[model samples]
Target: MATTTLGVKLDDPTRERLKAAAQSIDRTPHWLIKQAIFNYLEKLESGATLLELDGSAARDNEDRGELAEDAGLQCFLDFAESIQPQSVLRAAITSAYRRPEQEVVPMLLEQARLTAPVAEATNKMAAAIAEKLRNQKSAGGRAGIVQGLLQEFSLSSQEGVALMCLAEALLRIPDKGTRDALIRDKISNGNWQPHLGNSPSLFVNAATWGLLLTGKLVATHNEAGLTSSLSRIIGRSGEPMIRKGVDMAMRLMGEQFVTGETIGEALANASRFEAKGFRYSYDMLGEAALTEHDAQKYLASYEQAIHSIGKASHGRGIYEGPGISIKLSALHPRYSRAQYERVMEELYPRLLSLTLLAKQYDIGLNIDAEEADRLELSLDLLERLCFEPQLTGWNGIGFVIQAYQKRCPYVIDYVIDLARRSRHRLMIRLVKGAYWDSEIKRAQVEGLEGYPVYTRKVYTDVSYIACARKLLAAPEVIYPQFATHNAHTLAAIYQIAGQNYYPGQYEFQCLHGMGEPLYEQVVGKVADGKLNRPCRVYAPVGTHETLLAYLVRRLLENGANTSFVNRIADHSISIQELVADPVSQIERMATQEGGFGLPHPRIPLPRDLYGAERANSSGIDMANEHRLGSLSSALLATAHNDWKAAPMLGCPAGA
Candidate 1:
């Protein structure tokens, strides 16, 4: 019989399935098909002849056994036999590959039966290990403790996996002696180098221990009044990094004042650079007054600060340069509108006198924004001050507009119209509003129709850019001081201004510590004649304690983004890395340090511990692991304490 060889043909659906299966196993479909063919051929090939002799002629006989036993030869022969005309061989092959449910179900059941005992044995081993660890812990033995604990616990599969991972880390400690040596070395050397190569778990634990130890030491020193002594020593002479950190922490925490002495030093510094065209804005700490008296005190403090700056300017032969920012709420509250009007009536006249004096000295006053309720009052005051017959000088007054407000465009238009009508030049300092969360909460509490502050930041940013362009369009409006830290937004402002041909008509402003890179970049451009606008740094001056609110705001802003935090933590290997390393600096701050710990490293208070203990005393189950971890009971206790102590403080405002 004459036989013909045929190629395999697969249907589109079957071919797609085959390709997917091959992909799943990371094999080429051609390779898979060839392998399958070889497998099938091997199963069918019995004995086969490789050659034929001429009819009726005596042939040289070759041994069939040698070739018959060859697996490759048998496969080829089987494959040739399987391919027949009109056989639908491809479909047959696919069908053969598919398992019948009847067959599969029984096989699956049998496999489960086989695996059950193995799983049981594994669990038993784990239980034994965990039990041993528990016993050892009771007997106070450290060796094999982690392994034993893992074995005894009836953990879920995931937990079991984690236990194994943790055990690997624990075993890398070498021995108790080595571990102790490492700890002792780190403590004595005052530098803890993590051995993450050994195990990630060990690295994490070691880092946590280091932070805890540092925190504990700081707390103990603070409690023992050693911090004050350290401060004194540092004040006299200390390592530059230590001095700078401590000084910054102290100044930021508001525990010390921006003293008359500090102000004098600032003036001296400014005086040295004024001849080179440097200017200064002197700000006194204290704002958010609850009463007229409080407002008056803050006002008086500003007056005093201005007077000192004036005196210093007179002596240095440098006129007061246009720079000063003031918060409106510091003048009076909205609830006391009538009283505040009277307070303002008196305060405005005095402020006008200061402005007149400042005008004579060439100092500029910028009215800063506060809560939304105070925005109207701030703008009103600004309009009056700017229009006042005595203070209409080109750069005599400036007002801040928070671009986050939905109505900022209207505010900008109003200012432009006012400038046009009054024929007085105006300066606008634009900021993205700072009190976003507070404003939203107030709106919620007051049942306001909508949040006047733009809730979405993208919208606010767009508004800011629009307002910036609008302000830049008005040549009569002084070059606005654009205060922001957002690089993209800043770049956009610059782009829009350039596109509109207002290249040299805007100045950028940023906070003191933040935006250093951006500030330097912009300033460098100005210095190199790439740009002609000025760049200003808004340096905040106050004791660290008084600046807690500001610090909190900074933390909240950074912490709002989880990705930012994770990126920071990944880069920051230690506290020093977090504080000193530029990449990890931004996200190291805790968002809510209120009850978790002290606001600053130098000021260690027992707030969290005390709250937890109080919770325990008040019938809260502090011993509950979940409660301890979550800090729920501690929070309740703190709230209760605040409620109880509020009355003793004598009034709601005082509390």
Candidate 2:
């Protein structure tokens, strides 16, 4: 066998043993070492232990000198001395005797066992194991429990599958007592506190409980096979109860959520309260319309929503809570300027009418961004609407800016300039854009210029900070909505605003469900004059089926991107202790995989790593991200839906 030389470093005792062996072999230490190494290599190739090789006999005669001083020579001599000829021969004979009998005979026996009758028996055994596991008090058992609950709740098969996922998470908890406690808590409280304590047992139990309560369990399970299923069923044919359950689960998971009724109710509630501290932007859901007809329908639906919100608020003498947010793709996808204009022509008259009505009721309108391809169209529409004589007032119109887009800085400047010219207040809602993965994929597929989705996390964070600084610097810009749930981003904005001392002038906008504690803290401080800020929930309203896409998107954003939990755990553990007990760190990482900020199945990696390699090693994927987003989005969307729409537009034909 061909051999490669391997360098060796040896201790004194080992080197001395080698020298003695080389002397006994009656050969030069280097020559004896070479022979010893060759013999060991042959044994290795033959699958023999070095100690079982015959040539080791010679090692005793050749190594009596101070060749031990040479570490490499000592290593080879030591290896040669280990070979035992009798042991090697005995092992070879034994292997030969057993191999043919067992290996050859088992093939025929195995083939016979695979015949029809045997195959039937094997299938039966497999099925029995599966059934037993499903019913056992394990992870699979919890899955069964969720399955039963889904049936009892009359959820669709997909929804049922999603719910069962929550059950599986519950099963992952190690302690039986904690698991039982969590189940009892869920049954009694109708809510789950997944991040109760930092202990491993508590973390697992709480995460499992939270999954069930938030409906993320189902969503997480659904992540694997059904990418488009939720969106398809949303607003299509699912039962209202299914939608309600989805919404509830989503809210618990902390996502921005919306549903038709909740948005209307929020608007109505705002109007009734005459809430001067906040403004509302209503969004109508539905997207990727390939035809102008569908787009027109979308536009009409939005216009109707706008008018309904205005009318409702008018009845309550609330003039400010009437802004409506619209997605351009919902108006029509892939349209030329004129064709788009024609759809807009149909939409504009109604939008103008809504504008006229908003003038009477004092409502504002903001347009939302869609796919990157449709972004220019969305911006053009916003610009046109902003310049409209009827809606020229600063409080009456606004546009959204996705900070991740490379062009946003230019867009921000453009909007600011437009606002200056109109002598109107510009309401710019700043968001880290959605559809990041999709944008990247599309850019790659189309061979586009730049990745609008900031690949680096720091870049995105800095972009938000920079934009906030720019907007806050320009007092005429009305310090548009800072729409984010990131603590770091939020704190930075708060610090900047504090330094500038324009707290009330800027509004902090969070999704309806996410970061409730943070939102409350920020708003509470504002109320106490500690921060002095206005806050608004970008409350969305649409049917549950229609809202799942948004829900999925939110879960993806929160669960997929951040790894605060793992980092916190690592920091909490001392480096010296971690090094001494590596397994402890591994176990901690494993446990943290399901802790708060580390949503199960999509748990973030340890802080020391980067990119997809670490994520894949942890078994997290895009699907898990999507499911988390969907679950959180659904409930938040529903909460917003249930609120009364400010009556500026009529409900669509059906609702």
Candidate 3:
């Protein structure tokens, strides 16, 4: 190829700076300039702004050339250093787990401190929102199937527990033999006849009638005489009908929770909500991959979803349009800290590819938060992604922080610092958290010193508000996404965010089916009911087969008697009690108990799990990197010592 001469003038200082930046990485100024021009044109073609063509962009081009030229020790060193910030982040994350609830609560209170006047304003706003949500006409003037089921078969009741277990596990069972048995076991055990007409939901009542009849038919399978003969006939022929009914019921519940069975369908379903001024962050639902094939399958699904979603966006940009939320575990079989080297070598490259694709389309890609142990590992990936020269100026990179974790406030501080260092804004989604039950049980089983999450729900709420304050205060470096369905939490965040709102200063987030009604009162042009703030719908898109884990989490979250979504539909819960402040609740608890921010009285420490009958045996936390590292070091330290055993034949004679 022939090159044409292009002349550009620069001041002496500017020339020196360019030459120094080029020399730092051992490259000629001429070569750097040519690469920069090529990069600049490529960026322009890809729709990047002039501001994006800063020093970092030029360096990015040079770095690529360097890697190509010397693909040896220097490249390895660079990769190592890029992810080395895990040292700082790991310390922060490790410290978060198992902190004394009493200690953690006070810190959160101080961080979430609100004046009496501000509290009052928050209460008023939250109460108004709650009242409207209650009074608004539901689509059919009745509760949703899930809500109706929860109202009728509460978790405290055996029937409710049975239904939830069946709903959560039915779709994942593969063999027809097992499916039939599960249907028989779950349905036949629950007393469904009395609940037939108790629920006003046609869906719920229909489900009840099916369960009642199926139970009666399966119950007499081993009885004597006519009932037994009739049961045998029904069991042989009508079993398929029972299976079909259960399958339909599961699919119906799945449809209400999941947006669609695929990305294309999800986007089409999202259009109506988009038209109503609501944005979306689509989550492709699947659990952690247990095999490489599983990981690759999920990876392909995410890649396809990104392409389809990007096309659908039509250049609405990151903040204004839809985006994708990815689970890191879904892209790698072993995404644990113990497999740190494997993850860095394998998972990081895949993550970089996805981030680059999202950047090319000018869309956001958020890494969804998972279990407590993976927090720092995720930050390691996120830190590497942020500092990546190719992704340097892209503001579409997103992360999630679970406020229920004790380390949430500290994580916010670290993330803000990182965004400032990377010279780009990061989208941070603040959520109360999922996996609370599992986290608590895991700690108890392991005999860990303390719970990684809060023992009390109110403590988590306080932490959410406190974390929100931290995110809000750093406007330039962070774009805060508050994901919650609680009117009180929403109102407190709304007030704390203040009255003056720009297009993308900050926004609220809600789940797909559950949050729409509540947010309908908040997201539009300024009006009596609307708060005029943007709210993004976190929609899960997947077939019923992949929706098992997601559905279970949603049920556990909303089906709980104390959950905001569960209570919002119950008229017996007064507006005053419904919209009570978490901060105030904590303060009152502290005062009344005379123990400052004590843990829930009902929840015992892992050591005290058995109430003095027998001590719980200790188990290792294989997920905690710090613990694993310490154990490895200790074992290695004693490797040099040896002991020899000898026969004791002479001992008896000598004695």
Cα lDDT over the full model 2: 0.49
Candidate 3 lDDT over residue span 1-655, tens digit each = 2323443345699899988988898775666887999998999999877774468978788777765644433433333222322346557766666779887888888888778877899999899988988887655522266567667777766787887888877787888888888877877888887787876678788878877877877776666754666876796887788888777766776788888898989999888988999999999999999999999998898899899889988999999989999999999999987677789889999899988898888889999999998988898889889889998778999999999998898899899999998998999999999999999998998888778899888898999999999999999999999999999899888888888888889989999878999998898877655779999999999987789899888878877888988888788999999998888788888789998668778888888898879877777776665565566556544544675566778665544
Residue ranges of candidate 3 with Cα displaced over 4 Å: 1-90, 141-143, 193-196, 225-229, 236-238, 622-629, 644-655
lDDT of 3 at 233: 79
Each model's lDDT comes to: 0.47, 0.49, 0.83
Q: Which has the higher lDDT value, candidate number 1 or candidate number 3?
A: 3
Going through the candidates in the order shown, the clash numbers are 17, 82, 0
Top TM-score: which candidate number? 3
Ranked candidates, highest lDDT first? 3, 2, 1
- Tens-place lDDT per residue, model 2, 189-243, is 3333433343334334444454444444333323556567664563243323333
Candidate 2 deviant stretches above 4 angstroms = 1-256, 259-263, 268-279, 290-293, 312-322, 333-351, 498-504, 525-530, 563-655
Span of ten consecutive residues with least summed lDDT in model 2: 97-106
lDDT of 1 at 338: 30
TM-scores across all candidates? 0.47, 0.48, 0.83
